[model samples]
Target: MHAITIPEPGGPEALVWAEVPDPVPGEGEVLVEVAATAVNRADLLQRQGFYDPPPGSSPYPGLECSGRIAALGPGVSGWAVGDEVCALLADGGYAEKVAVPAGQLLPIPEGVDLVAAASLPEVTCTVWSNVFMIAHLRPGETLLVHGGASGIGTMAIQLAKAIGAKVAVTAGSAEKLARCAELGADVLINYREQDFVDEVRKATGGAGADVILDIIGAKYLNQNVKALATSGRLAIIGLQGGVKGELNLNALLRKRAAITATTLRARPAAEKAAIVAAVREHVWPLFEAGRVRPVIDRMLPLSEAAEGHRVLESSGHIGKVLLTR
Candidate 1:
C-alpha cells in the first residue's frame, strides 16, 4: 500500500508519498480500501509536530475517509465485504488502506457518491455534536458560526436552518459570505471588515445570538461573550487564532451563559461510537432527503496530498478538499 508520510515537521513539501505496509483489521475493526479522504486543519497541525495521533493510532494525518470494506475483524457484524462506507478516523486515513473501528463506520447515504461522501463525516459530526448536541441550539434561536465558508461552517449553516434556527456566519470576504447565504445563513458578517458582535446583535434586533460555534478561540473570546444573549452557550471547537485569553467572570455571571470547549481526536472509543450512531440515525436521513450534503472545493490524487495541504493553508476554498486513492 502507499501512504503520505511526513519525515519531519514543516510545509507541504514534507509530505512524501511512498510504499507502506498495508493495514489489517484487528479485533472490533475493519480494513477499508480507501477511496477518498479529506484534509483538515488538525492534519496541518500534526504535520507541524504540534499535534500527535492518539495512542495506538496511525501515524498518518487524515481524520476522515470514505471507502469499501475489504476485511472485518472478529466479533464485528451488521456489515460485510465490499460495503460502501465512510468513517471518522483516529488517524492513518491518508493511505490506501486503514483499519478503522467497526463502530465508527457509517453507510454512504442514498443520493451521495462514495467518493464525495468522504467529506461528510468530519464536518457533519463536528457541527452536529458541537452546535446541536453540546450547545443545545433550538428553533427560533440565533446561532453564530465563525469561518462561515469552512467545511464545518457550511454544514453548520444547513443544519441550523433545517432545524428552524436563525443562522449567522462570519467570513473574510463577500464571496464566502454569499456562499454561506446560499446555504441558508440568515446573517453574514464580513469579519475582516465589520464587527461581528455588533453585526450579530443588530441582525437579531439587539437580542444577541443564543449559540455561538467558535473556532478562533482566545482571539474571539471577549467579543463572543459580548455577543451572547441571556443564557447563551459558546461552544469552542478550534483555536486557530490562539490558545489563551482572559475571561470576564462578571459578564458570564450577568448573562448566566456557559462556555464549553472540546476536540474530537482525543475522545474515547465509546464516545466516538455514540456520535457515529447518532449521525447514522439523525444526520444520514438529511442527506437522502437532499437537505444537506458535502461541500467540496477540490479533489486531487492521493499522491498530491501535499497540494491538498497547500489549498487548505491558502484559505481560498469554501469547503472540503479531498485526496483520492
Candidate 2:
C-alpha cells in the first residue's frame, strides 16, 4: 500500500509518498481501502510535530476517511467485504488501506459518494458532539459559531438552524460571512472588522448567545463568556488563537454559565463508538433526506497530501479539502 508519510515533520514538503505494508485488521476491526481523506487543522499540527498518533494507532495524519471494506477482522459482524462505508479514524487514513474498529464505521449517507463522504465524519462528529451533545443546544436557542466558513463552521451553522436555533457566526471576511448566511446563519460577524461580543449581544437583543462553538480558544475566551446568555454553555474545541486565557469568575457566576472542551482524537474507542452510534441513529437520516451534506471545497490526489495541507494552512478553502485515492 502507498501512503503519505512525513519524512521529518515541518512543512508541506515534509509529506512524502511511499509504499508501506498493507495493514491487517485486528479483532473487532475492518480493513478499509481508503477512497478519500480530508485535511484538518489537527493534521497540520501533527505535520508540524506538535502532535503524534495514540498508542497502537496509525501514524498517518487523517482523522476520517470514506471507503469500502476490503476485509473484516475477527469478532466483527453485521458488515461484510465490499460494503461502502465511511469511518472516523484516529489516524492512518492517508494510506490505501487502514484498519479501523468496526464500531467507528458508518454507512455512506444517501445521495453522497464515497469520496465526498470523507468530508462528513470529522466536522459532523465534532459539531454534533460539542454543540448538541456536550453543550446541549436547544431549538429556539441562539448559537454562535466561530470560523463560519470553515468545514466545521458550515456544518455547525446548518445543523443549528435545522434544529430550530438562531445561528450567529464570525469569520475573517465578508465573503465568508455571506456563505454562512446562505447556510441559514441569522447573524454574521467579520471578526477582523467588528467586535463579535457586541454584535452577538445586539443581534440577540442583549440576551447573548445560548451556546457558542468556539475554535479560537484563549483569544476568544473572555469575549465568548461575554457573549453568552444567562445559563449559556461554551464548548471550546480548538486553540488556534492560543491555549491559555484568563476567565472572569465573577461574570461566570453572574450569568450562571458553564464551559467545556474536548478533542475527539483523544477519546476512548468506546466513547467514539457511542458518538458514532448516536449519529447513525439520529443524524444519518438528515443526510439521507438531503437536509445535511458534506461541504467540500476542493479535491486533490492522495499523493499530493502536502498540497492539501498547504491549502488548509492558507485558509483559502471555504469548506473541506479532500485527498482522493
Candidate 3:
C-alpha cells in the first residue's frame, strides 16, 4: 500500500507518496480500499506540521474518504465486505487503503457517485454537529457561514436552506458569492469589500445572525459577536485566521450569545460515531431528495495530492478538491 507521508512537514512539497505496509482492520474496524479522498483545511495544517494525527491513528492527512469495505474485523457487524461507503476518518484517508471504525462508515448517499461522496463526510459531520446539534439552529433562523464557497460552506448553505433556515455567507469574490447564492444563501457579503457584521445585520433586519459558522477564528471573533442576534450561537471549527482574539464580554453578555469551538479529529470515537449517525439519519435524506449535493472543485489523481493541497491553499476553488486512486 502507498500513502502520503510527511518526512518533515513544511509545505505542499512535504507530502510524499510512498509504499507502506498495508493496514489491517482491528477489532470493531473495517479495512476500506479507498477509491477517493477529499482535501480539507486540516490537511493543509497537518502538511505544515501544525497539526498531528490523533494518538494511535494514521499518519496521513485526509479526514474523509469514499471507498469499499474490503474486510471487517472482530466485533464489526451491520456492514459487510464490498460495501460502497464513505467514512469520516480521524486520519489516513490519503492512503489507497484505510482502516475505519464501523461506526464512522456511512452508505454512500443516494444519487451521489462514489468519487463525489468523498466530499460529504467531513463537511456534513462538521456542519451537522456544529450547526444543528450543538447550536440547534431552528427553522426561520438566520445562519451565517464564513468562507461561503468552501467545502463546509457549500454544504452548510444547502443544509441550512433544506432545514428552512435563512442562510448568509461571506466570500472574497463575487464569483464565489454567486455560487453560494445558487446553493440557497439568502445573504452574500464580499468580506474583502464589505463589512460582514453590518451586512449580516442589515440582511436580517438588525436582529443579526441566529447562528454563525465561522472558519476564521481570531480575525472574525469580535465582528462575529457583533453580527450575532440575541441568543445566537457561534460555532468555530477552524483557526485559519489566527488562534487568539480579544472578546467583548459586555457585548456577548448583552446578547446572551454563546461561543463554542471544536475539532472533529481530536474527538473521542463515541462522539464522532454519534455525529456520523446523526448525519446519516438527518442529512443523508436531504441528499437523496436532491436538496443537497457534493460540491467538488476538481479531481486529481491520488499521486497528485500535493497539487490538490496547492489548490486548497490557493482559495480559488468553490468546493472540494478530490484525489482519486
Candidate 4:
C-alpha cells in the first residue's frame, strides 16, 4: 500500500506518496480499497504541522473518501465486502487502503458516481450538523455562509436553500460569488471588496441573518454578531483567520443569540456516527432527488496529492479538489 506521508511538515511539497504497510480492519471496522479522496483545509493544516491526527488514527492527511469495501472486521454487519461506499474519516483517506469504523460508512447516493461521492461526506456532515441540526435554520429565514465557494460553503448554500431558507454567502471574487448564486445563494458578497455584515443585513431588509455558518472565526466574530438577527444562531466550524477574540456579552444578551464552535475531526466515534446517520437520513435524499450535488473543482492522480494541496492552499479552485486512484 502507498499513502501520502509528511516526514517533516512544511508546505504542499511536504506531502510525499510512498509505500507503506497495509492497514487491517479492527473490531467493528472495515477495510476500504480507496478509489478517491478530497483535499480539505484541515489536510493543509496537517501538512503544515498545525493539526495532528487523533490518537490511533492514520497518519495520512485526508478526511473523506469514496471506495469499495475489501473486507469487514469482527462484529461488522449489514455492510458487505465489495459494497461501493463513501466514508468520513478521522485521517488516512490519502492512501490506497484505509480502515474505517463501520458507523462512518455510507452507501453512495443514487445517481452519484464513486469519485464524486468522495466530495460529499465531510461537507454534508459538516453543513448538516451545524446549519440544520445545531442552528435549526427554518423555511422563510435567512442563513449566511462564509467562504461560499468552498466545499463546506457550497454544500451549506445548497442544503439551506433546499430546505427553503433564504441563503446569503461571502466569497472572495465575482466568479466565486456567481457560482454561489448558481447554487441557490440569494445574497452574494465579495468579501475582498465588500462588507458581509452590511450586505447580509441589506439583503434581508435590515432583519439580519437568522443563522450564520462561519468559517473565518475571530476575524469576523464582531461583524458576524452585528449581522445576526434577533435570536440568531452562529455555528463556528473553522478558525482560518485566528483563534482569539473578545465577545460582547451585552450584544449577545440583547439579541438572545447563541454561538457554537465545533471540529468534526476531533469528535468521538459515537458522535461522528450520530452525525453521519443524520446526514444519511436528512441530506442523502436531496442528492437522490437531484436537489444537491457534489461540487468538484478538479481531479488529480493520487500520486500527485502534493499538487492537490497546492491548489487548495492557493484557493484558486471552487469546491473540492479530489485525488483519484
Per-candidate TM equals: 0.99, 0.99, 0.99, 0.99
Clashes of 1: 0
- After superposition, which runs of candidate 1 have C-alpha atoms over 4 Å from their true positions? none
Q: Candidate 3 — number of clashing residue pairs?
A: 0
State the lDDT at 280 in candidate 4: 97
Using lDDT, rank the candidates from best to worst: 3, 4, 1, 2
RMSD each, Å:
0.6, 0.7, 0.7, 0.7
Scored by CA lDDT, what does every candidate get? 0.93, 0.93, 0.95, 0.94
Candidate 2 weakest lDDT stretch, 10 residues: 286-295
In model 3, what is the error at residue 70, expressed in angstroms? 0.5
lDDT by residue (1-325, candidate 1, tens digit) is 9999999999999999988898879899999999999999999999999999999999998999999999999989999999999999999989999999998999999999999999998988888888988998999999999998999999999999988999999999999999999999999899889999899989989989999999899999999999999999999999998999999999999999999999998899899999889888889989999999889999999899999999999999998999997
lDDT of 4 at 308: 94
Model 3 Cα lDDT, one tens digit per residue, 1-325: 9999899989899999999999999999999999999999899988998888999999888999999999999999899999999999999999999999999999998899999999999999999999999999999999999999999999999999998999999999999999998999999899889999999889988999999999999999999999999999999998889999999999999999999998898999999999999999999999999999999999999889999999999999999999999
Question: Candidate 2's residue-wise lDDT over 1-325, tens digit each?
Answer: 9998887989999998999888999999999999999999999999999999898998888999999999999999999999999999999989999999999999999899989999999888999999999999999999999999999999998888888999999999888888888889899899888999999999989999999999999999999999999999999999999999999999999999999999999899999999998889878888888778788889999999988998999887898999998
What's the residue-level lDDT of 124 in candidate 1?
84
Can you give the lDDT of residue 44 in candidate 2? 95
Least accurate stretch of 10 residues (summed lDDT) in model 1? Answer: 124-133
